[model samples]
Target chain A: MELFESGACDLAIKIKTGTISSEEVTKAVLQKIEQREYDINAYITTTPELALKRAKSIDIQRIQGKDIGLLGGIPMAIKDSIITAGIRTTAGSHILENFIPPYNAHVIDKLLDAGAVIVGKTNTDEFTMGSTCETSYFKPARNPHNTGRVTGGSSGGSAAALAAHECIAALGSDTGGSIRQPASFCGITGIKPTYGRVSRYGLIAYASSLDQIGPMTKSVKDSALVLSVIAGYDNRDSTCLNEPVPDYLTEIDSGISGIKIGLPKEYFEEGLDSEVCDITMKAVEIMKSEGAEFIDISLPHTEYAIPTYYLLATAEASANLERYDGVRYGYRAENPENLYDMYCKSRSEGFGIEVKRRIMLGTYCLSAGYYDAYYRKAQKVRRLIKEDFDKAFKTVDAILTPVSPTPAFPLGSKINDPLQMYLADIYTISLNLAGLPGISVPAGKTSDNLPVGVQFMGRVLDENLLFRLAYALERNVGTSLTYEGAVV
Target chain B: MSVTRKDVDNVAALARLSFTDKEKEELIGTLNNILGYFDKLSELNTENVEPLTHILPVQNVMRDDEIKPSLDQETALKNAPKHARGHFVIPKVIE
Candidate 1:
């Protein structure tokens, strides 16, 4: 039986029932990575030996009548940012090209505990910066649907792997729509969990306040499974919520009957690709017929989201990225004239163009005299944006919006224009700014077959509700592209 | 909003990064263009709005002031580009 078309849940049952072996599933996924990664560039590192080892152990445990956990024998890919001990983890930067971590990230530990085998590390925008996954130091990760187009990034590789069926599922981090945007472009489902919902101890920080690690998968139910395993408190991350983790699988099927969904007029306004807009409106109608109510609401501060996000995210990124100073690890400049010379050369040489641009921008924003006008003002507007969502949530249960303005665009289109690239994140950045839970599910495809994702954002700590709504939408539109498009 | 070559050079210095004359010219243009977009925020008035440093309500995370085992020097220095005698090697300081 070809296990590549199935999801983690289905594969778990197959492994538990003796219908298939864990080694077999791992082999299939590994083969897929080997075959498709050349064209897709989805993986930065593929752990064939380790994956086989984990799989062989799970198979042995099953033969001995031992109970494996929920993710037992499921093959998965991890974004490069997550630390995996003894595995070469590069957060898609040349500086960390050969640096291997001495410890596993909290999520990696959790996934291993749940019997998930990580097959590879996916590519990402360098330092999780860029909207298109083009900034990766390794190579550009192309969209699986159309080779000429790009996978929306910083979590582009993970989303691409999921789209190409190279891995059963993968983990992605969203600072300002990294996960959701790529998931949208690749035609998969991804959840940017509430801030602090997942531990960030191992995630390479871009914007500490807004960065979150979440799951990208072929289906909403699979995302729920991956989330259940990874989401929770870890003392290592101060921001990790101490609240109890809910069994998302239990209530996901509860359906969004009588759920008052908000259609933010601002999201449907100008610049949204008409086809993308139509697909989301059609999704609303599909749910409206299924007992979901759509309400016209406004996030008045929507227009300010781009400027505000750019300022604040870059500010945080500048500070957070200061750690890469050519000191204890990573890349270093050779034969520096002085300590100062070493710091400048190592960073200037190690970082890519976009990373350098952001660091410079951030440094400029936080510099004296200009700080209050830019950084402080952006933070103030950020509050207004969050308040806007808060007020709208009072009247509606959840908000639905288009994931991106357009479908997968050609790779080079926005690369040269910084502002144009930043605008691609318009719909998704505010959720991060406000620290809310947002999920992007494949709603429909354009006439040209490019995928369009519909976003559903829930109030803080309302991931369970978000999952339920995503499940509702998924059941109606059915864009689980892993099976439908996995003709290979 | 009128960022110039001098502004880019100053920011690059603060960021501890260096670039060539050509790159600096490009940087000045890009920075100026981005600043033009950022200038849009000036249109909104935020007289009484509080700046949210963090989205989460939690502040000042506390942990017990206790000693625990830490990463050993050998493992910690494993990736150091230049190291000798359990210390990172850097260009001469305190000249």
Candidate 2:
């Protein structure tokens, strides 16, 4: 009867066999949401009526001997940034508080086609900018593991929903560690596929070059199952690759034999927490024992990632968000004296402090006097960062490092200091800069009981290699801490 | 390395967000501290390095010149704050 704890594939089989009716499963998950929704603050909008309607349709199909889809009767959640037709899609900002999208994102369309029931829209940071979900107009999502700590942002709500058993799996966008970090914080698995691997037509853009839509689930196989359905080229997004999508679930149990993982010295440097470092090294040793070779690698530009990412992301954000002026759609001032007043009042009132800060920094970097000095120079550094990853990949199949320097901090810990919050994304940002694929798996737990995640970064379109290594580590780790009463 | 109030005002204007004088003063301090950390990048000699815009090797991905159906006017204008005659309406600019 507890459908939230089962894997998506298993749930589909149960539905097919009539072991559990789709209506019963939906009610169980809705009951779980009713119990824990306030504690985690995961869902911004819950759609029980729509979910029941969809479940009844699936039951009808089964009774008539029609073919049901792979994800038939499975309940799922989507990050608020992804548009859902006829649903209120607020990107955790006041700007579009009342805005209801008229169309679904490309991935949403795919999930519906697969017969997956979308239960709700999860919370996120405003425009997917902050590292902590605290920036949302809604209440900050709490870490289901530790109530006082944070669920990582801007996909924190999606991750928290999975961790708390509110949903089996969810969709999240990783612009710069949005999906991976939150998954790490909430003790779950998440993947950011290679750039152009998935369609981004319906995803709200934060940084066009860096944003990717991927899966956040309770296990590696579940993440891959969702990826198999969503990863493909679409004509709607010109940047989407026209290559063949891999059968990720087919290789979930593939052993990691003769696999080589790179351990970059730069990632284990001074700033990383001792507890995080110890757990990561243990994870590396576990992989080594599983017939995986360890090689010492150098990515000298690792330290430069923080600055390069902030500069480039903000610059793009300034340009992309320009479409939200008062004239067209989105929020507007109640009363405006003039044209300029309307523009200023609307933007100033709608955007949060962090969003405004990034926009200003972006505008400055792209200005007439500073463009060549700041923006252009940062772009050059971004090239060297990519080269570092390219050069390292030649010696190793994938690179392993801590997803974050530390476990999830307290809710309001880094909200005041923007730079400190940005620093939390140090390890995950460079992968975005290089457009590589990265996956985060449960590495180990800190001494104080917080979950630590180890990230595997792979070469372009080499997501299979990363998944193989992650599955090996997850099996070898040998400890599955239950969410109930695990927090100290 | 210290940012000035003038710098904050200029950046705000470029970003098209109006800030009160107190907010401007606060931002000046914050921006200066943040920009000060970026000085580390100047130490590295990146003269010959080319600026990398995208990670994947592919470039210039273009769609075919085929016309497609667009969103209807009603659906497009549904979220607009003010609209008239299938177009977004704004305050009059010219006298």
lDDT of prediction 2: 0.86
Looking at model 1, residue A157 earns an lDDT score of 97
Summarize candidate 1's per-residue lDDT along A181-209 as a digit string, tens digits.
99988889999999999999998889888
lDDT for A86 in candidate 1 is 92
Off by over 4 Å in 2: A478-488
Predicted candidate 2 versus true structure: per-residue lDDT over A187-228, tens digit per residue: 888999999999999999999999999999888877888888
TM-score of each: 0.98, 0.97
Residue A419 displacement (Å), model 2: 1.0
Q: List the residue pairs that clash in candidate 2.
A: none
Candidate that would win on TM-score = 1
Candidate 1, residue A284: lDDT: 90
